[model samples]
Target: MKALIISDSHGWTHELKTIIDRHRNQVDVIFHCGDSELSENDEALKGVNVVRGNCDFGDDFPEELIESVGGVTFFVAHGHHYNVKMTYVPLSYRAEEHQANVTCFGHSHVATAFMENEVLYINPGSIRLPRQHPQGTYCICEYDEKEISVTFFNTHGENIPELTVAFKRK
Candidate 1:
């Protein structure tokens, strides 16, 4: 299965729409890690699995989401509640509690992906205001029975090859 993960669009609905249109057919799921700053019912988020960020005031948005796809369990959160900017420990603990195979979050605006204790953690960065990288970015993750491959792409849809990674699934 394949998934597209993005976060921190901060109200750029047009961009979100473009991204959805671009990858809708290629991915089985699309997730927004939060801070979309748009209403939960916005057309731009029609088929997306979205969580609420610190900046999001929509009561309709959930604080976290748990989804199962292609036998993989994913825990999605905005990260601010877990203090992810300083450490992943809090988030890691939560993922353990949920028995999640992967955890997706965004808050620091810095893209990163890694595996810890068999759980994959991914932050797709901010498409509106990225940090520690030249271009704002998102991520595409593909997984099968053996491994998961992740590729980061800038807002313009260009892949950032240096950020691509693959890991063995537990």
Candidate 2:
């Protein structure tokens, strides 16, 4: 299965559309990790599984979403409630509670991916305002019964090799 994971667009509607468009034919699932600052019904958000971010106001969105797509269990969130800017400890527990194997989130605006406690945690970073990297970033993952591989890309659609990671599914 292939999934496009993005976060922290923070109001750059066109960029979001472009990114989705660029990978439209390549992914089976699309997850937006919030901070879009757009309404839940916005055209750009259509067909996307999104969670509420700190910047997203009102009760327009849920605090989190847990879904199974293409046989993969995903726990999606914006990470403020769990203090993602500090650590993934709290978020990990929540994912564990849901028995999720993949956890996707955004809040720290830093792109990272890792395997811990037999679960994969991914932060696609901020596609608008990024830190720790020169350009804003996002990620795509290819997975199956054996392994999961994630590759980060810049706004222009070029892959950031240094951020790409793959893990043997246990």
Output candidate 1 Cα RMSD.
0.9
lDDT of each: 0.93, 0.93
lDDT of 2 by residue, 42-161 (tens): 888878888999999989888999989888899999999999988899999999999998999999999999999988999999999999999999999888998999999999999999
lDDT of candidate 1 over 26-101, digit per residue (tens) = 9988999999999978999999999999999959789999999988899999999999999999999999999998
| TM-score, one value per model | 0.97, 0.97
Model 2's alpha-carbon lDDT is 0.93
Error of 2 at 167 (Å): 0.7
Give model 2's clash tally.
0
CA RMSD, predictions in order: 0.9, 0.8
Give the Å error, residue 115, model 2: 0.3
